[model samples]
Target chain A: MERNLHYLKGSFLKDRLFANNFIITLLFVLLALAPLFLSDFRTNLLGKFIAYAILALGIDLIWGYTGILSLGHGVYFGLGAYCMAMYLKLEASNGKLPDFMSWSGQKVLPWFWKPFVYAPVAIILSVLVPAILALIIGYLTFKNRIKGVYFSILTQALSIIFVVLFVGQQAYTGGTNGITNFKTIFGFPLSSSSTKVTLYYVALGFLILAFLFCRWIVQSRFGKVLIAIRDSENRARFSGYNPAIYKTFVYCISAGLAGLAGALFVPQVGIISPAEMGIVPSVEMVIWVAIGGRGTLVGAVIGAILVNSLKSMVSEGFPAAWSYFIGISFVAVVIFMPYGLAGLLNQIKRKIYTQKSVKQYSSAALNILEESGCDEYVG
Target chain B: MLDAICGRVKPAEGKIIFKGIKDVTEMSEHQIVELGIGRKFQVPSVFMGITIYENMELAAARKRSLYSTLFTKLSKEQMERIQDVLQKIGLYEKRYRTPAALSHGEKQWLEIGMLLVQQPEIMLLDEPVAGMGRKETDKTGRLLKEISEKCSVIVVEHDMEFVREYADKVTVLHEGRLLDEGNMHEIQENPKVMEVYLGRGGEGCD
Candidate 1:
């Protein structure tokens, strides 16, 4: 009996040592440790990656699990960034109207811009605007059952239209230039190292929170319905889950997260532009999710970091070849990883655990039954 | 059973007053399913992406949130219930295999396993043995007979042999209307059923 207890404890310890949980917590610890040793530039780069990860996770919630591949996620991100930028722009002007409008010969700030001049309202509006847009779009599209590639095309069109409008509207939106060269965020100078570090950690905190939030959502009952829709949408409908409601909820959540990420991003990146909200940039975010593993949270983070960090290195090292690298990598990950890097890791983890548990459990259980003299009862 | 078991195919029309005042429009399809009104499609609607076990787990996982499903391990009791249902349908060996790899007969059995796990108050199976082989059809008939002992089962099938073997009661649907409802013998010999089943374009062997 004592021997059996020891074996069980040993197996329990063994399981904990290499569990998916252990790995995830370890990675988080590593991320926390990174900034301590890394320089400001690298820390800022990591912050940028975390922001991108947030976007990818939101997209994955909509596109990967819910099977609603949206092209308008960039618009959500843009909305958040624009809101944060509006506040920054307002603060930079020091209670006066912004320079661009002053240069363009405007006497007063627009009524719509007046509300956003306040930080709290801008943040609320930033998240709300995208959610409201997504809710409407999701309602119209999903109710009509406009699925497959058609949905993708419609979203892509939205992205193009948003970019065009943002670009063309120069006076109100800052047009092609966008609201940039921000001197302050909530009265704190961006030039200060402490502020930069604080913002970096803020971005990191938000990213971690987003990851945990998504992780919870994906593991919830609502998440099973999502996978059901993904696996077989028709089945989910007949089973009594309104696919539209699930789709709408997840899409809004995705939009809200993207908007939140954008809000965080603007402070760190210090700009919001039509260029960043364009068709290609939005599609590139999708690529990050695809290459990382769409269904897995960590995959989103890893893919963002790996791709962006590589891009940073390549831009400095090889410049123009970066696009070629991105293109080839996208195709390679799609064709080879099919499940993505996280999926590959999951497969390895499963095999290891399955082998270990099957062997250890059967022996332990059999011995327990034999000792207890209840083998028949166990069967 | 016959009037309560009337021709209303749309579950949205289900009206059951409990103590006379609470509206259950908020009750979802899965809630209705859990409340014992099991539904199967006209065509088999298996989760084609997963294994027979995982498909059952997906239904079982409905009881859990996405986070619990992703993080928490399935308890032994849950695994046992899944295994028992699979074994009842003789698909225990194929539990680990994907639905795409399953044969039409196995797919039917898999659906039955899914229903068995759910153990609904009423089982609504549509064309349960539509594309199944003779032996597999016999196995399905036996499975249904076993399932019928516990709940009210309504099967929508064109196979006269399957209905005759398993149905305690039969309802014939023609042009989205319930043409006739009775016991298997009554439905088999009723002039209206004969005329409808044998008379409906003679496309099927009566």
Candidate 2:
């Protein structure tokens, strides 16, 4: 009887998940067709949103699932963007010094920018640089057991330091103005509408890949251990899991994903700046996860797109009141729906399904009780 | 003593010899666990977010690497072992349930079940029957007795009745110092043990 009940519960969950997957498929299809209906500018904006969605997946993996709340993801994103931008700027300069370097009176390209001239090298460095940086940071912090709000604050401080260093280095980096005026990526003119459209599809593909990657990680035993660590680090540690190692591993992966997103983001957005790596942007990245539903990969994507779209709309329509509107919405989400929008949807779905299951269970129990004639009560 | 053995606290002096190996005092908890010494926390530190089955799976002494955990599925043998432990703990029926859904006694049983899955050479359980009712306590005592047939079982418990009922060899501690080490009957009859419990004036053991 217990086995039968377990089977019933399992099948019910499978059915509900199937339905959710169907909806998600439809959503993806609509996103795929969006560029056909929208203008070039809107499509480009959507491409940027997709990049944010990818970054949001990283945040979800680290903060939502692993319980390591990093407020320095913007640093990873900026690092990746800078890598890609440096490559593009070098390519545009045709082996000469980039415009900013000449303007700042540098004789040649910086040693760091030299390797970025190769597209493959640039792409690999874009991901690896941020991943390595995150490894260093994660090693220092996790090894010391710096966690919770303290970890968040440390990440925030790292972001501040990154931004300050980048802004200060006007010669090597573009500083306040950032690296811009990109013409091509491997001879494909970025200014062309076709390139923009292609880049949009590329961003969407990466987002889908990231979503699947995160989904797989969360479903695996590794993901279970992450949730275990999140719920009780001490318990996880005693269970033979080295919490510091797992924490550092997840942090590195999260940073790598953020870097991948930023690399994709640069060509479409046409610039990479220290301002993008500021503490505020990093905090906003976290808010996207919170609003979408932390610990849910699809929710992170939805949350990023929805929040950024809303931000764009509000800022464009009412610039003066945008911050207040965003702040109030965030507060409202935190207060009224602590689990976020996706969590709210799941709760409702669970309530309805649980009601149906409860009815079925009661009828089954009644039949058992009646047949047994009070010999036993099965609940 | 359990904490020291499990490397939760350092002895500050003296070596911890385990399984004929000397000086395990500097080992981490994970290293100590790897040495086949399982310690269950007093508060029943089961992973609350995961189901009871997954908790046992995590505790199982196999393929603990990150890569293995990421790629490998539970083997038939591991699954059978988990089922066996769950059955022994009387939690097989609720194996799919999360720790939060369990009763306090059930949580204790689940934690014990977790340790059992590790197949440790020695088990140190802290307050295994602290919050349990008489029936649960009796059941746990019986379980521990049965478990002792396979390996050594050391239980740190405050319940004198429980200690008297299950313990074959009892060691009494007072102010972090060993007061007496003997059979339950001997310890109960000993003046030092009586003085430690009775505080110089009480009539007898409760």
Candidate 3:
């Protein structure tokens, strides 16, 4: 009888895992086939949203799993987008000064922008710059044990600082007007429908890879330590785990993911600006993870797509009402769905699983009572 | 005092020599933990966000460096050690559950199990049985006694009966100053302890 109960428990877990995998597979299929059914413009728009989804995954890692809220991920994303933008801008200039540089009265391309002329260099720097920035910030803050809301406020300050710095640098960074008028990437026209489709697929592919990578990370023992740090830093410290090291490492990785997202976003969107990486957009990235579900990786992806799609759709007709709509929904999500959509789904799944198991256990107990004459003991 | 030993609180004066080499006061919390000292708080503090098994796994991990933790999986022996500790603490059945699901006494045992997996040379427990009932307190006393055979356990408690029953040696403090130090019988006879702690008249605590 005990063995039978154990077998039932084993199968119950297997069933839940299977259901989760099936849902994920279905979502991936829908996303993969979206371009086939949608127009080029819509598909390109999705590619941009997918980039934001990648950024959302990073936020979920730092905020949801590790419990370190970063309100300045936009800086990382902006830096990455700017890196890619610099490369494209240089390519479009055709061995001459970029339009913004010439307009700002710069005679020659800056030494810093020279390296970005190479596609490989630009791509590497896009990811590295943000990670290094995060490393510096994380190392300083975490080592000093600055955390919780203080850390969040610091990140907000970072975003504001970056926006100011970017806007003030007219000659090198294109200033308030920002970098635009991209002609081609890798000898292919940016406006071509075929290029748009390819970039969309590329963005989708990266999203999947990033999702799987993050999923693997959170499942590992290191992931457990991350959660442990979130729960109690003192307990984790006494367990011989350095909370600072783990926090800093995860922060750097999260920043890198944001940077990668930004790199992908610029090509699809065809614009990069200081406004995009300011405090507002950074906070918006966090909302996506919150509304999707914080700790769940899949939830981050869904939340990003779901929220952005809603924004695009709602803003089309009632542009003035878009912020109000998002504001209301975010407040509602915080109050009612603290765990977000994924957490709500999980709660429902657990409810069903428990009910089913309780029924099975009762029936098994009835069989035992009948066979062993235990009914006499049951009053 | 326990916090100072664990490097949670820095000492303003004097040194805390561990194994006659390392000064715990000079180290950070994790560094102190690495130097063979494990501390349990008055409250049973376990990682409530993760499974009991994971809490054990994190403690059992030999190399606490970032790279090792990221890349390495627990060996079979480490897995066996975690299982053994879990069974010893009577939490084997609930290993997959989070600490929130455990009873108060069970959470205390799980925290002990976490320290057990680490096998530190010295275990510092501040009121290990602070909120436990008599039965649970006795059980914890027995567990600590058994654990003491492997490593030295320094426990702070106010319960005279518990101290008399379990502690090998007793030290009575009055206002952060040592009033007496001896076995239970020797302590009960001391006039200083009788006056300062037991409330005059040479009468014993109930």
Candidate 4:
């Protein structure tokens, strides 16, 4: 009993586990009913936001927990989007070269694009390619002990290189215009409202799955190690953990999650451009994780949806001032609410619980003292 | 020298043979740690952000692989081992507190406890009682004496009193070269050791 009490004291795992479950359930319920209450266009917009939320989840896993700030996540996201886009384009073209390739005078399908003709192959490649790339990059950087600002700058450079490469290959990648004007996905009309709604649900499902997966990782002993690494890499290494290998593994996993989000995103948004894979979008992705609460999985999702929603609303009204609004909000979050939205919520909950416990303990102590005084007086 | 032996730095020209085999001149720190050689830094390097118990858990992890750490739950024996170390270090009451909450000497004890949980074949502690009060230093001396019974312990310290009380054999170094080697009594009587410690030309003892 004493051991159990010891385990329970300050174990954030026990309290947050219940709260996390409740929030997840509520979120799914809201997502499931969103289609019924919203128009087709709005629902489609929400689908796109859900995709960003998935990407933010990936950012939180790497940057928030592992302390590996990757500004090159857009590269993985773009790779997955392109992979899915290739398959969709092939299905639309009926086994011929996509329109842009033919327009550019290429008579043959690129050998790399051939494997994506099969849906299963495309999906598998979409996830694996990004993971593999991340593994190689992680091995190179981490093995050399390149970390902190250096790692972030390296990732930013990667994003720029990918953007330039994608834009340069006009015949293969569709260049700055990106792959678009798709008519169908697996014989279902992409333009159909019903298809859009169905795709929205699919994106929502994947987002929840990604969130749960991240939560599982963070709760496990592995997650504790990641936090330990973030706190002090040298101390963790001295404790026998190979910090490089752990960093590489988490980096690859983060890349894979971003890839999955991009795979879903391409179909919903109907475009996968070099612009989407550039420095700005990648930095914006980090901002979402930052504003949400770096370490909290739910905070990442909330931050993504809220920031993107705010962006759309602000842009629709003023157009030129949305960037200013985003900048101010990021600064405010950093200064005033460093822990982000979830952290604020946790703080409030803790305050209330602690106050109530304090009251109960004090009152019990007073009663004991009074009874002891009465006993002494009677004696 | 402990840093060199633990592969934190490569020696300019030397080989470190442990247990009469496997020259560890080019081994990485992780490989050296795997060879049953544990090292404690001069400064207490416990993870400050985590609870002391979690620090113990990290040190007690057997596999140390990314996947195994993710899935492996601590066995009853592992828990008992951690508890034993905590009790031995007298930090069981503060196990749930972060290392930041600990006193300097407590942090030192926690690091010693971390090493003790690993149960290494050889332990290298650097200045274990550097900032400790007299009471804590005496306790540390007792602890080291107890630890030496289980494994070979080499402590690098400048505290002559601690060395005299706890150390069975002493190797004295002067200006990065071996000056004398003997028990504390013999070292006190040696002329060269005296020159290095007390007979220096009016500079005063270090």
Candidate 5:
């Protein structure tokens, strides 16, 4: 009557994994075929959401599990996007340097700009730049024992600093407007319908791959060590696990994934800017994870999708007070649904099954009542 | 080993050797932990985000191939060892539950269990009964006595009752300095220990 799970001896855990993977696989298939039926707009929108979901998962890995809320992850995301955006910009320029440079009265390309023309170099730099930044920040903060709300604030400050630097250096970074107007990726036409579709599916493939990578990490001894740091960092040290190393690993992983997401996102959306990598955007990224469900991978994915979709809808409908709507949504969910949407859905599922099981249990009691002559007690 | 370290010069300033090795200051904490000089914390530190099984697995330090740990699943044998350790700590029922939900005493109990799985030669415990009730304390005391048979136990506890029941040799520390070291009876009767642990009037622990 109570679901008969205990007798199965871990069958339920195995089944849950299988079921989750199966659902993810189905989602992948659905997404892959979506471009065939849906218009370019829907596929592009879906591609954008998938990219955002990747970002959310990345943030949640550090903020949710390790308890290190990084508001600078958006900076990492932007770095990756800027890398891709630069390559796209260079390709569009046809081996010539960007127009803005010539307009600024430059004769030759910048030395730092030469390597990014290579696609592989751009991708590698996208990952390396963010990893290096996170490494430096993580090393400094953790070494100083700067944790709790202070660490969060530090990361947020880093985000602000990155955005300001990029904006102030407009001569090279395209200023506040950032880079856009891309026409090709690895020599493929960007505006072509099929390329767009292929990019969307490619994004889907990468998201699934990222999910597998994250799953491997969260299921590993490294993950366990992260949990240890979350609970009691000092205790983790006493147990022979240097909390600094584990934190650094997770932080770098989170940043690298954000970079990966950003790389994919730049092509699909055809834009990358200083605005997208600042403190506000980073905070927004965290909200996606929070509104979905922190610490649960599916929840992070679902939350990113749901929140971004709501943003799209609300911005279209209200356009003026969408931020207000999102703010209210955040407060309501945090107050009433601590576990967020996934937790609420799980509760609803539990309730429905509980209602059915209760009815069956009552019927069983009724049979006992009839057989044992306990009708008086029932009445 | 006892004479060199008991009340002698500081460890960093002077050489104190163990086993067959002498003047061993180059060993890392991980190496020290691996080489039988085990230490436990004041708080259990039971990795709140993951399950009890994972905490045990880390303490067991028995992973086969670091790469395999990342790619492959934890084996049945690993799970069984985890369960066995959880059972030892009386926390098998809460194996899947996180430490955030565990009571203070239960966390302490879990700390004890996780450390036991490490198989340390000289276990360094800190107030193992701090935040526990009489039942939990009594159980922990018995467990400490049982554990002390195989390994030397150094319990840094203020609970005199726990000390009286479990300590084979009691060392009193006041203001970051050891005041006395002897069996419980000798420590209780010593003038300095009485002044430090007991009240100024020379009354015994309540």
Candidate 6:
């Protein structure tokens, strides 16, 4: 009977894993085929949404899995976007100072901009810079045991600080207009349709990779410790897991993912701006995760695409009403569907399976008892 | 005092040397735990988001560094140890369920099971029976008595009857100062204990 119960439990877990894999595959397949049906302009827009999905996945990791809500993810994303933009800007200038630097009356490239002239350095720095910053911030705050909404507030302040820094440095950064008017990336014209489609696929590929990575993390022993920390930091501390180290590491990983998303986003969207990294966009990034399902990786992707699509469609028609609509939807999601879309789907699935499982359990129990003669039963 | 030992609270003055070696007061809570000292809080503090099996897995894990935890799986022995602890705590049947499904006493037992899997050299329990009923308290007492055979068990408890039944030695404190120290019977008979703790003819104060 005990063995039978164990077998049943094992199958139950396997079934959940199977369902998760199936859904993920289906989502990816649909995305992979999207370019076939979507127009070039529409596909480019979706590529941008896919980039947001990657950013949302990062948010879900820190907030959903680790219970560390960060409202400054936009800053990391912007940093990556800026890195890619700098590289592209340099490529556009063809060995001369970028147009912005020349307009600002700079004679030579800033020392900081020189490193970004190399494509590989720019790419690596996009991811590394945010991760390093997150490590610094995470170590400072988490080591001192600062957490919960306080962490969120701190991240918000970080976003504000980055925005001000970028806006104030008009000579290096592009001031209020930000970095735009890009010509090419590695000699491919930015206006080319082929480039747009390829960028869409690239964005899609990264989103899938990010999703898998996040899933791996939340499933590992370390991931369990993350959930453990989220639930009870003191308990994890007493269990021999350092909450500060774990939190800091996960925070860095999250920031790195956001950075990757930002890098992917810049080329397709053709702009990297201070406005993108402001507190407003940072909070909106959180909203994407919240609306999809905070902890569920797939939900982040779904939520990002769905919300962005809605915004584009609705805002195009009802520009003024879009704000009111989004505001109400966010409140509605928080109050009515706290678990978000993915959680709602899971609830419905469990509701459908509950009766079937109960019957299966009782019948299996009876079979086991008959076969093994109930003698070992402790209950 | 338990908090000081667990590195949760800083001591005003004093050194806590573990096994005549490491200075526990100088370490962090996780570092002290890594040095083979585990603590059970007054309230059951199992991870509510995960399953009971996972709670045990986290406790049983020895290589708890970021890289090891992320990349490696628990060995067969560690996995078996988790199963054994769960069975001993009588939670094997509900191992897949979250701690939220557990009753108060079961949560306490689960917490104990978690500590057991850690196999700490010394276990510090704070009010392990604070909210337990008679039967649960008796069961926990038996559990701790069994655990003490393998490692040092230090319990900070106020239940005098419980201490009398289970403890090998007793120390009575009055306003953070030691009032009496001996076996349960000697402490019971001590005039100072009677004056400060038990009160008048040993009727019991707690």
User: Which model scores highest in DockQ?
Assistant: 6
Off by over 4 Å in 2: A359-379, B201-206
- Docking quality (DockQ) of candidate 2: 0.73
lDDT (Cα, tens digit) per residue for candidate 2, span B22-134: 56798887777787888888887888878888888888847677898899998899889999989999988887779999999988888888888888899999999988999
- Give the per-residue lDDT of model 6 (tens digit) for B27-111: 9898899888989999899899999999999999998999999899999999999998888889998988999999999999999
TM-score of 2: 0.95
Give the least accurate 10-residue stretch of model 2 chain A, judged by summed lDDT.
A370-379
Sort order, DockQ high to low: 6, 3, 2, 4, 5, 1
Q: Under CAPRI classification, how is model 4 graded?
A: medium
lDDT of 3 by residue, A1-379 (tens): 7677777778887878877777777888999999999999999988899999999989999999999999999999999999999999999989899998888899987889989989999999999999999999999999999999999999999999999999999999999988999999999999999999999999999999998899889988889999999998889999999999999999998999999999999988989999999999999999999999999888899999999999999999898999999899999999999999988988899999999989988887787777788877654
Query: TM-score of chain A, model 5?
Result: 0.89
* Local error of candidate 3 at residue A316 (angstroms): 1.0
Over the full model, what C-alpha lDDT does candidate 4 score relative to the true structure? Answer: 0.88
| Candidate 3: clashing residue pairs, number | 0
At residue B155, what lDDT does model 4 achieve?
95
Per-residue CA lDDT of model 4 for B1-206, tens digit only, reads 99888877899997989999988787877777788888898888887767899999988878888778878888899899999999999999878778999989999889988888888999999999998899999999999899999999999999999999999999998888999999999999998777777887646635
What's the CA error at residue A187 for candidate 2, in Å?
A: 1.4
Candidate 6 lDDT over A289-322, as tens digits, reads: 9999988998898999999999999999998988
For model 1, which pairs clash? A218-B66, A219-B65, A219-B66, A219-B67, A220-B65, A220-B66, A220-B67, A221-B65, A221-B66, B36-B121
Candidate 2 pairs with clashing backbones:
none
Taking the tens digit of each residue's C-alpha lDDT, what string does model 4 give over A1-379?
3443454454544565677677768877898899999989888988999988998998998998988899889999999999999999999888777999988888898889999989999998988999999999999999999999999999999999999999999999999999987778878999999899999999998888888788889878898889889987877777777889999999998999889989999888888899989999999999998998898888899899989989988999999999999999999999988989888877887786667656655555556657668655334
Q: Candidate 1 or 5, higher lDDT?
A: 1
Ranking by TM-score: 3, 6, 2, 4, 5, 1
iRMS per model in Å: 3.8, 1.0, 0.8, 1.3, 3.0, 0.7
CAPRI-style docking class of model 3 based on DockQ: high
Off by over 4 Å in 5: A1-6, A349-379, B1-35, B62-84, B99-103, B195-199, B202-206
Report fnat in order of the candidates.
Answer: 0.39, 0.76, 0.85, 0.59, 0.54, 0.98
